[model samples]
Target chain A: MMNIPEDISPWLAIPVVLLLIGGSLITLIGTLGLLRLPHFYQRIHGPAISITFGAGSFLLASMLYFTVLQQRLVIHELLITAFVMLTAPVTAMLLMRTAVYRDLRNGRQSPDLKPPTPPASGHATTAGANSPGLMEETRDRNPE
Target chain B: MKLLVEIALYFSQFCIVLAMLLCMLRLLKGPTAQDRVLALDTLWICAMLFALLLGISFASLVYFEWAMLIALTGFVSSVALAKFLMRGEIIE
Candidate 1:
């Protein structure tokens, strides 16, 4: 995989190297966190770093390296950066929400799990972990 | 400097490959469905980064497009899976 072209300047290469190595290392740590962290919530944070800084640096390095090599601006990587940034949080939030609600549905207890906010102007306290509220039951129509 | 870049690229490639392996292990052994989905999301990101690294080492432009397409579709699948888990339906 060492097919990087010649004639590239040293100055352009240094930052690329630093960003590449640092980002890769960060991603490794984050993935380790996903695997080794004791809980789901803690494990979730691990990949956050991967999707953000890790991918960010890799794309940035790709941009810099290719821009220097091709002798023109190569900013298309930004589209990826933007997509990741925009979607990452939504994905993470939805996954966390799913995890929490599933645990509640199955009555799986976790100290990390926080109680949902009580609904306004209603007896929301009646909803227990195993017994979900009418609204929730209505929302999830397909029963397992 | 070329030598430094070469060495760094190799090392980074190795690291990302290792990271991808770790993510797969989590995907396989994650205690719950949500954990698995999260691992899948992370796996795609790792894969994308790996592609970018490959682009650098090979000096090819195709990997960049591959990375972009992966990035575009990965989030949708993750979100859809999570939605299915949450709502018991992907489209409803």
Candidate 2:
């Protein structure tokens, strides 16, 4: 395998390495959060953090590294950056909608239905709301 | 220096591998189908980044193309999975 030239300036290398490390760390933390978050709604936010900023830093570092190595502007990495920016949110929103659809179909009280109620009681009430009055009360509090 | 670059690359690779493993754990343990699908999407994104990091470390352009392909395929699969979840079937 060809090695990165030893003669490249530290100024460039340092920033590139920092970016790469920072981005990878962000991705690691985000994925860890994804695994640990209790509810799907909360968990949905975890990947978004990585997808937006984590991938961005990595792409920027790749662009700079290749540009320095090739001694020219390396624009191809831009394609991945732009494509990811466009697609990640779309995928996230679609998944969120799907989750909400599933919850509603099962008559479960989804997060979007309420602002920030305690999850335990919300779940309990929604689980056994044989009376429409309680459902109405939930809707009244949420208003959406 | 080459040492610094090497260190950064190795560290990034290690982090990404851990990230992918966490994503897999979520995928396998997710309570609902949508949760699994979301985990799969995140997993693919992590894989794409991993490929790019490898490309950077090896100074090989081939890995960039691999990364791009992974992104394309990952997006398509995720969209299809989401559609299936939304409609109960992928095709009408």
- lDDT for each candidate structure: 0.84, 0.86
Q: How close to the true structure is residue B74 of candidate 2, measured as C-alpha lDDT? A: 97
- Please identify model 2 stretches exceeding 4 Å from their true place: A111-127, A130-144
Per-prediction TM-score? 0.85, 0.86
DockQ of each: 0.64, 0.61
With candidate 2 superimposed using the best TM-score fit, by how many Å does residue A108's alpha carbon deviate from the native?
1.3
Candidate 1, after superposition: displacement of residue B3 in Å? Answer: 1.9
For candidate 1, give the docking quality class from DockQ: medium
